[model samples]
Target: MYAIVNIAGQQFKIEQGQEIFVHRLDGEEGAAVEFDQVLLVDQDGKVNVGTPVVEGAKVNGKILAHVRGDKVKVFKKKRRKGYQKETGHRQDLSKILIEKITF
Candidate 1:
């Protein structure tokens, strides 16, 4: 079975034993997390879609680790005016393993 769930303001299609990276979540490494915002689920070709979210549906996962994404560099320059700016950023992320999906 597979499910489309909302986590940290993003939607993800997940299945059992699948690992995914998402925006950082609270709790420690190896922590168990439950996502209740399941938008849809497919069970052997039969599908269940939610009106916003499926009631009583949940996606269970384990937080494997916390990590940071690669840095993104931003540079700006103005010709003749001799103006320049540079900045970089890295996004905090969490790796999670999907354990189960139940409804």
Candidate 2:
């Protein structure tokens, strides 16, 4: 079975044994986390949706590792103003392995 869940202000469709990268979480490797904001679930072609979230529905996941995304370069220039700016950024991320989804 699979379900749509909310994680770090984002929605994701996930299934058991699946791995996904989400916004950074305050957990160490091998730590466990629970996502209680399950929006919908599909099993055997049957779909269950909630008003906001499904009551008594949850998704269990294990923290695999903490990671960083590739650097992004931002450059700005104003022609004839002799002004230029450059910046770079990298987003912190976390890897989680879905263990189960129960409703």
Candidate 3:
């Protein structure tokens, strides 16, 4: 089965045994997490959708590790002003492994 869930202000399609990275979340490695904002679920072609969220539906996962995404470089330059600026950033992330989806 697969489910569409909300995590950290983002929507994700998740399935059992799947792994994904999301915006940083609280919890340490091997810790467990559950997401209750399940929007939809599909089980063997049977679909179920909710109004905002499905009641009694939840997504369960395990925190595999805390990780950092690749660095992003931002550069700005002004013509004839001799002004240049450069910045780099890396977003904090968490790696989670989906364990189950139940409704």
Candidate 4:
């Protein structure tokens, strides 16, 4: 079985035993979390979809670790003005292992 779940305003297609990195969540490593905003679920060739989210459906996951992504550089320049700006950013993220989907 698989599910499409929403976490921290982002949607992810997940399955059991799969690890995914998402926006950082407030929890320690190895903590369990449930996502109630399940948009779609598929099991045994049957699929259920919700208008926004499926009622009585949830996705369970375990937080594996918290980490940061690769740095991204932003640069700006103005032609003939000798004006330039440079910045870099790295997003915080969490790794979660999908455990189960229930409906």
Task: Please provide TM-scores, in order, for all candidate models, with all chains considered together.
Answer: 0.96, 0.96, 0.97, 0.96
Best by TM-score: 3
Q: Could you tell me how far off, in angstroms, the CA of residue 7 lies in candidate 2 after the best superposition?
A: 0.4
Where does model 4 exceed 4 Å of error?
A: none
What's the true lDDT of residue 20 in model 3? 99
Error of 1 at 22 (Å): 0.6
Tell me the tens digit of each residue's lDDT in model 4 across 1-103.
Answer: 8889989999999988999999999999999998999999999889999988889998889999999999999999999999999999999999999988899
Question: Which RMSD values do the candidates have, in order?
Answer: 0.8, 0.8, 0.7, 0.8
lDDT over C-alpha atoms for residue 38 of model 4: 95
Instruction: Give the per-residue lDDT digits (tens) of candidate 1, residues 16-53.
Output: 99999999999999999999999999999999999989
What's the lDDT for all of these models?
Answer: 0.96, 0.96, 0.96, 0.94
TM-score of 1: 0.96
Worst 10 residues of 1 by lDDT: 52-61
Give model 4 RMSD, 1 decimal.
Answer: 0.8
Give residue 4's lDDT in candidate 1 (0 to 100): 95
Which regions of candidate 3 deviate over 4 angstroms?
none
Comparison by lDDT, 2 against 4, better one:
2
